[model samples]
Target chain A: MSTDLSRVADPGSIKLYTTEPDHHDPITLRSIGFWLYMMSDIMIFAGLFAAHGVYGDAYGTSKITAAQVIDPISALFPTLFLFSSVLFFGLAGVALKNNDRKEVLRWMTAAFVVGLVFVLQEIWEFVKLAQEGAVPQASAFLSDFWTIVWAHGLHVIVGLIWMAVVLIQVLRDGFTEAVVGRFLNLRIFWFFQAVVWVFVYTFVYLMGVS
Target chain B: MAHHQSSPIDHPEIQSASTLQYVSAFVLGLALMIVSCIITLGGGLSQSSTLTWIGILALIAVVGQLYLLFKLDLSKTMIWHTVSAVLTIPLVFISIVVTMWMFQYLEMRVMVGGS
Candidate 1:
């Protein structure tokens, strides 16, 4: 194809084009971007999960297995806490729909509190496991267990921090487009964490014992 | 931007939020969790069967959360989000399922005393 010299000369008329669909709405863009990030995050967790599946039952020379180290019954409490946290966060979304700033803060605080409990409960469970000779160094199974669970725990901690930041922004600046966008993105984030937790609970704790 | 200026709450992303759906989703998840927990703890089924049950429950919970919490719907505002998510479904299966299959074979062929 011959070069369009005249088009190049008129730089102002040289309109750049892209193959991707035009996404001009900031709100739509924000959500799609966040969902893409969540997909990447899911891949990270997927790798951890696969690693866990491989090493989960690999007790090696040790007599301890995943069932011995993990207790689904004890995990039930933290699982409930995490689920309730998601529920409260969803309620916060409802509050945002009504533009009830105070109610939004209230529901979000509830979400944060329950989320904190979930994290604390997880740490406590890990501590107890470690005390019972189930440290990551003990066996391949324990190593995988700790790695996956702790990975999820770290995400929860980050989610909590993000939740706190959004709450503060709403309190200080009111609900601007940016703040609301952040809130909506965080909604995806918080829900994504809960979904990850479901798998972790199932494959790690429940199926560990199964 | 000035012409579009309005309450952020009026955004369709916010307007579609539903408390009832959220509550029901949570309850559904809890029910699945409870049932799986009982079956797992009771040891009524074989290991493979128990694993299968747990897998089914987890799948249901994930779907419920995607539908209710994330609003993966066909509405005007949510359609793109839904499409992006649906596209990722294959990757999700490939990542977890394919990895498990590969590792299972490696365990049998390479690991000593593997079944």
Candidate 2:
């Protein structure tokens, strides 16, 4: 049996038909890989939350202040602030896409300041809790509490660093195509912080108060 | 992997951002957070009911964020990430539910005076 190979080419040109799919270029691969990494991060959060659900109330024979140490009012600021940062970071993404260099930088600076305020408030919260004698080593629940919240805090810190790098690069290089991927990834990272905080507020803080 | 000739600006995800979406998500998210605080501190609901309401509100907030901020949707290119993110739900539910249940039974049987 003979197979008739069909090809479309210019005169005196040679081209072969490819049966296999084209490989993903670096850009596509970068996004897919980053998304997969984020999925794994989600799993880590799930495990931590499970630990919290399991041992969150294991303070036996010890004075459990429970929710009294955490002020609900204080918690609201961080949520609003971080969510606002997430919103501003998103606006930065829009600016980046629109090729507006200065606007992207401005949005990023605003996001950074708002995000810093959130981190500082969180630090203040931890300090107040420590002063109230509800340190990480207070009990099993506090251990889980500090671990999860700090894990999130660590992410926020890293996000701040990444945001700074992206901003600096954009400042030096302008909003070229080369920087879009990095900026987009930072947007995703910032959004993840807000998402995780929702879980923290729901499971840990709200439940504690309840 | 298939390279279409569309410009990068024409990509759905890149151009999906909007001030309306952002502000709405922010306001709605802020409201949900405040509502949670109020339910907690206002002493309107019982303990279990408060937990339930807060969880429900959180789900609403997360769904809103996923839509407005992340711009996740069921489009051809976006569905991959969206499905991957949503796939973790079963894992989270199972992990939290099973672990909490296991420990709850264990404590009920073998211990006393759980906080």
Candidate 3:
């Protein structure tokens, strides 16, 4: 086919054919920023894990071993909650891809609820352990145990609050680009929390019990 | 850019997998959990060697879940995740092992001196 060179040379038509890419792609920037933040947080967990590992058995005289300190039954519920939240967040991602704002909000809300449940379960577990004489001050193992687990629990609490704020924002403004970007970042954060929990659960509970 | 949006269940990547794959993964995960629980609760495997093996198995199970359940691809972006995870595991394990060893050594020295 012969192309119309004259038609393509129209100056006004050329004005509509600009090839400049949009520079305001906040989603890409936010994703990269969130990944950086996750890496930093991973470093923080690394530090805590190292600290706990080094000081875990400093006091060897205590009757409350790591096995005795961790209640598997109490931990199981929270583990389930956190894992389910990851699934719900995956659902939220799907909802966002489909441009379903209502479903996005619904899944996010479910995730937030699950997160809250996890935090509460953790709190209860800690309290029960303390009441049963597994106090942090009782031994170095207990101290390190409480510190690592409590730090993770605090992260869950913060994540729950973050989810709530994002939920409110989405409810008020719907799924704007900024909101979706933040939502995606928080989803990554939530998944990272779950990832860390697997280690904590394995090392602290499983290894401790063994 | 051409936008290719598809429902999660209808997505080609997800749809290509047989349901049995998912079911088997879930069942295997549950089995791992049970095995971990048994080792921990059986109260017969408290020695350092047994615990070490249990820990290694638990770590493997965690990796398995990440691969099977989450389907985390080892793509460019995921390389960092894998690297950090691998590095962190050794760091944590070595620290714990060294500390426990030092503590036991000190206890032995104290006993010898007291005798």
- The structural similarity of chain B in model 2 to the true chain B, as TM-score, is 0.87
Error of 1 at B115 (Å): 5.7
Q: Which ten residues in a row have the lowest lDDT in candidate 2 chain A?
A: A1-10
How well is each residue in A61-122 modelled by candidate 2, as lDDT tens digits? Answer: 54865666656776777888899899899888778668687898899999999999999989
Error of 1 at A185 (Å): 0.7
Among these predictions, the greatest TM-score belongs to 1
lDDT of 1 at A206: 92
Candidate 1 per-residue lDDT, tens place, B66-88, comes to 99888888876778788878888
Tally clashing residue pairs in candidate 1: 0
User: How high is each candidate's TM-score?
Assistant: 0.89, 0.89, 0.72
Docking class for candidate 2: medium
Cα displacement (Å) at residue B48, model 3: 3.7
RMSD of 2: 4.9
What's the ranking of the predictions by lDDT, best on top?
1, 2, 3
State residue B44's C-alpha deviation in candidate 1, in Å.
1.4
Q: How well is candidate 2 docked (DockQ)?
A: 0.56
| Residue pairs in collision within model 3 | none
